[model samples]
Target: MKIAAEDVTPVAFTVILFLAWEGACRLFHIDAFILPAPSAVFAAAAHYWWPLLKNSFVTLWTTVVGFILAVVFGITLGLVVGWSRAIYRGLYPVMIGFNSIPKVAVVPILIMWFGIGEIPAILTAFLISFFPIVVNVATGLATTEPELEDVLRALGASKLDIMRKVGIPRTAPYLFGALKVAITLAFVGAVVSETIGANAGVGHLMVQAGSNFQMPLVFAGLLALAVEGILMYALFALLERRMAGWAFRASMSAAG
Candidate 1:
């Protein structure tokens, strides 16, 4: 099989960026404590592979669990809100107000309730990620065409029938797009809560390394997080392509 230039571009760019970083570090005689070079970060990762692997897994687990919860709850609520104009109008303001508060501030309250553990991290991840999913799904469904609805009514389609046949299919692209964004936010939420309260996770490991002036390990932890986030985003992107590729094709055809 032949590899496409599109597939190679990001890898090439990343390599160039890292090479530049390594060169700059050597040229400037930069202190390792300030900004560890790529080599130093790699060395730290190799030296403490077990801790990095363990903490990375812990963070991934919490993030995935939280994201699952968000998907279930978010979809359910989005459908409810999208079902009616009154419900959508009544709820949008409250949801906006809630989402507006910084998630970090809510972490303390979660810790107080859950007592500084994985629960707080999980809840924080759930809280941070669900809003976009809800908003996107609701918007998709609520924006369904009135002309189509009238046609469906003329054809003797019930409200539920129209929703099942049209609303959800149309909403799939929006929901999947939301999923990609939500997963990243979930990771952020998990790591933030871990940094503040949890006993284990990449965030906690980074904090410990920073305290001991282990800048290389701190950067390695960051790298682990980036790898995880990228993998998850890619997974959702793949799933979106598989599940809603028709939508993309339709839109492209329309544009053309």
Candidate 2:
């Protein structure tokens, strides 16, 4: 198979970025404690591969668990809220207020209730990631074209039938879009909770490395997190395209 420019561009840019960063550090004689070169980071990763792998797995599982819970709960709540204008209006403010609060603030409370473990990380991820999903699904349902609903009703369709045939289908693109956003947020939430207090995880490893002034190790932890986040986001993006290809094509065509 031939390589496409779109695929090559990101790889080329990433290489350029790392090369520039490494050159700048060498030229400026930057202290390793303040900012380790990419080479040092990779060396740390190689030396501590086992620990990094174990911690990365812990973080990945916790993030996936939390994200799955968010998807189920968010979709259910969004549907309920979007079923009626009154419910949507009443719940919107409460949701907004809750989402506005920094999730980092809630990490301590979760840790207190769940103790220092994966449970806290999971809950923190769920809390931080569900908002966008809820909003997108609700908006998609609420904005269903009235004319379409009228035609369905005129054909003797019940409210449930209209919802089943129209509202749910319309919400697919929105839900998928939200999934891409939520996955990233879930990673943030999980890592934040782990950093606050955890026995194992990339976040915990980073904290230990930082305490020991192992800047390269800390950067390796960050690199692991970045790689995981990018992979997860890409997975969801691919799913979105596969499942909602028509919606995506329409969007692209419109933009063009």
Candidate 3:
């Protein structure tokens, strides 16, 4: 019953939040241009449903494509770095430097090169998200117990054998955790890039609406983004629990 109540808490709180927002707007007689109520946002969404759907699809695909690339590249690079102390040390600083730079700044350069389209958005998503995966995966492998490694070595296990038998499997939880984070970052990157240059997307739609003083439509675009982001994040959270159930169980046991 406690677990069930805990599960309902977020939904309940979200309902309360929207109710409060609507009441506040009504009580203050807030200008719609400044802060459209949830009802106004929903009405705008229903009215512009088709454009929202089309642009949302565009954003979704771009984010997914970029996230897929980030996963493949991040996992492969992480494995290579984690395989050796020297390589990891040498590459770590470079990766830090790269990740520290704002991805929004990179968008203009991408636009210049790609000439305003989905490609830039995809690349932006890839660049923004790949770092966390790389860090988490490499950390997972690098933190493998030295005592265990010695035991494996004593049993005549090679480095490759240890990595295949232990390191990769141990990193599964870390990889999935990073995926949840990276997927959200990927959405941010795609939207940022689209807002900067793309001809179509939720970001672009919001920009257009804002310029036209259509605050309700602009807020509706934001609502669309929030819904999509929540769904994607939830999907990965479910995947993490499913794929790394052992890790979850172990952590729960440890906590208990």
- Choose the strongest candidate by TM-score: 1
Order of candidates by TM-score, top first? 1, 2, 3
lDDT of 3 at 126: 100
lDDT, candidate 3, equals 0.94
| Model 1 lDDT tens row, 31-99 | 999999999999999999999999999999999999999999999999999998999999999999999
> Between 1 and 2, whose TM-score is larger?
1
Which candidate number would show the highest lDDT if scored against the true structure?
A: 1
Where is the poorest 10-residue window by lDDT in model 3?
247-256
RMSD of each: 1.1, 1.6, 1.9
Clashes of each: 0, 0, 0
Candidate lDDT (C-alpha), each: 0.96, 0.95, 0.94
C-alpha lDDT of candidate 2 relative to the true structure: 0.95
Residues 1-256, candidate 2, lDDT per residue (tens digit)? 9999998999999999999989989999999999999999999999999999999999999999999999999999999998999999999999999999999899999889989999999999999999999999999999999999999999999989988999999999999999999999999999999999999999999999999999999999999999999999999999998898899778668652
Q: How much is 14 displaced in model 1, in angstroms?
A: 0.9
TM-scores for all candidates: the values are: 0.98, 0.97, 0.96
TM-score of structure candidate 1: 0.98
In lDDT terms, how accurate is model 1? Answer: 0.96
Model 1, poorest ten-residue lDDT window?
Answer: 247-256
